[model samples]
Target: MQRANAELVRSLGAVRVIDYTKEDFSASGHTYDVIVDTVGTAPFKRSRGSLGRGGRLLLVLATLWQMLLAPWESAVSGKKVVAGPASERVEDLRFLAKLAQEGSLKPVIDRRYTLEQIAEAHRYVETGRKRGSVVVMVSHG
Candidate 1:
């Protein structure tokens, strides 16, 4: 992760933020019960050694092959690979909204652009250096 983003997550109570550019967290001799790979950079093979027994690897952006191999991997290793779309139930969304409204949930927004600048926004995001959510403003209000 970028340095600024690392600090942002730290401020949000992240126990530790591994800057992959400088460190290889998996080789650090630490084990975790759950590792969430939001960007799909950490694949099952690369992360298997870092997981404790019965640990879960949640792949938010899994490839088709990874999804297909998840069950077999889990069966053999006792570590689970969960790869799929996220649940977007209304109640869950409402709960998140409530948390945000109550100031209990803080979202990191790295940048905002007007609707007209959407193409530029996409270009920037494609660079893969963005630290947090990039908002596209549809209206002034």
Candidate 2:
């Protein structure tokens, strides 16, 4: 697990950052109120079991099957699946930015590459092993 990711999660009130590479969260016998699967590494079917009653699974990168099933599942089950693109609201964006500025929210920056090394950044992101955002340093001057 990336230290930045672990720290960021911890900073945002995470009791624990389960390293999925080391341990299987679903098999740990602990259910969660909300599970945010950003990488789409854990499929919705396997992860639904990890949610408590009336819990939510927020998928940032969902599979076609999961996307198709989300609406139907929400209508029929207590566990809700929230997937797809988020609404782009100016107020929401500014609120989040302000939180970051105030140190209330800290982004986990996995790696930084110069503008000259943008391709390297893309390659790293494509690997999908990045714990957080891969920053490309662009010089505006």
Candidate 3:
């Protein structure tokens, strides 16, 4: 909601924001170009709703077994719901670095924890509703 209020929501380039907590995103009937799904806690089946007619969904953290049991609807239909590992090539890293260097990049760190405060870091991250990445500061001794 902060992102929406800030008017900087477009920074992520996502046309519409889906708050999975408040509502079921599948009911929106909104077709997404690329749905990068990192969270997979659903069992009621909702792959089709997130994808367009020929859209693609990139599953980031699905297990090998889950990938093997890929959604039947997505395969039968033209829409592709990719499962399993996402290989990060050298080019991807380069692109990330380039983007980070650009003024368009900004790291949203809700909390910064020192290496010695690992427990505190875990606690902060367990809140499960962070806008962006949480930083764990590593001291170079």
Candidate 4:
């Protein structure tokens, strides 16, 4: 984890944050209830071994092939591989807003850009090294 992002994640009550630059988390022989793949570099096939029983692998940046195979893999295994476009629901948004208001949920912003820099933000996100969310500021002026 990047030093800047690590502080945010820690503040959010993450028990531990592995630094991928210095260590391989998968090779540590530890299993987790939830594994979120943000970079899309983790191996889906081998990830099954990393999940505990009834665990979930949330693929935020899955490839097309990974997305296609997720359902089939879930059907045959106890673990679940979740990947796809997300649907926005009012209830979920409300809950998130509540959390944010309570200071329990703070989004980690890796970079910020104005509306005019949207293309540049897209390119940065595409690089897959962004530690957290990219903010695109919309000026009312």
Candidate 5:
């Protein structure tokens, strides 16, 4: 996780950053009020067990399979798991823009490549060593 978005994590006020790749996240013995699984991988399927009592798991990239499956699991348990569509509306974009303008947040730019270098840029982004977002410089004349 640290390697995935180190700079963004640092600047975003994450006091303690854990590397999920190094160890099992559940073994940490910590509970969260809200679990936001952005990537929808790894322990996301097990998020219910890790949550504190009355905790909620918010799945951002919810798929049809996950949506149907998660609801069934939640119905039998006290902990609730809710999945939202991956679509982003204007309000969401506005909020993000506000955060940026307020200086509360900024996207970490791992690399900047010209539009002509898109293939190379994508290759670099796929390396899994990216510190943050790989930017493609696209210019319109």
Candidate 6:
């Protein structure tokens, strides 16, 4: 996590936000029961030490090799690694939508682009500088 987005992340219910640029959370000697990595910056090998006994690491995005090695690693070690594509259930989507509607959840939109500017939007996203979700508007007109 970047220092700039730390506050925003904390406001979103994160108990603690570690700026990877300043410190390495894995080397801090602290352990967690569950660690969800949306990006592949923290892999199983590097994160194993940070996990407590029977801790679970959820990898939202992982390589094929990592996915294949997950089960073996979990079996060998007491910690578990879960790597796979997320399952989108309609009920879950509806629940999230309800939360957003009730102001219980707030989404951060970093940028918005019209359908015609989609190419430019892709370029910006590829740069990996966007802090939040990029919206592409489809105009019928």
- Give lDDT tens digits, candidate 1, residues 14-116: 7867887888879999888888898888999999999998999999899999989999999999999999776689999999999999999988898999999
User: Can you list the residue pairs that collide in candidate 2?
Assistant: none
Ranking by lDDT: 6, 1, 2, 4, 5, 3
Q: Roughly what TM-score does model 4 have, to 2 decimal places? A: 0.82
What is the Cα-based lDDT of residue 38 in candidate 3?
73
Choose 1 or 4, whichever is better by TM-score.
1
Taking the candidates one at a time, how many backbone clashes does each contain? 0, 0, 0, 0, 0, 0
The residue pairs found clashing in candidate 3 are: none
- Span of ten consecutive residues with least summed lDDT in model 2: 39-48
> Compared with the true structure, what per-residue lDDT tens digits does model 5 show for residues 1-141?
646465568667676566777866667788776777767663345776678887888887788777876777677767778775657799989998999999876777878999999999989977767776788898997
With candidate 5 superimposed using the best TM-score fit, by how many Å does residue 35's alpha carbon deviate from the native? 3.5
What lDDT would candidate 2 get against the real structure? 0.85
Q: Candidate 6, residues 1-141: lDDT per residue as tens digits?
A: 655688888888888788787899899999998888877889999899999999999998889998999999999998999998768999999999999999998889999999999999999999978888999999787
Candidate 4 C-alpha error for residue 124, in Å: 4.4
Q: Report the Cα lDDT for residue 9, model 2.
A: 78
- Tens-place lDDT digits, model 3, residues 27-130: 77666767776766532156666677788776776766668766764667777767876689999989888989995667666677788898987887778655
Ranking by TM-score: 1, 6, 4, 2, 3, 5
The alpha-carbon deviation from the true structure for residue 88 of candidate 3, after best TM-score superposition, in angstroms, is 2.8
RMSD of 5: 3.2
Residue 124 lDDT, candidate 3, scale 0-100: 76
Worst 10 residues of 1 by lDDT: 1-10
Model 3 error, position 106 (Å): 3.7
Q: Which stretches of candidate 5 lie over 4 Å from their true place?
A: 1-8, 36-40, 58-64, 74-85
TM-scores for every candidate against the unseen true structure: 0.86, 0.82, 0.74, 0.82, 0.72, 0.86
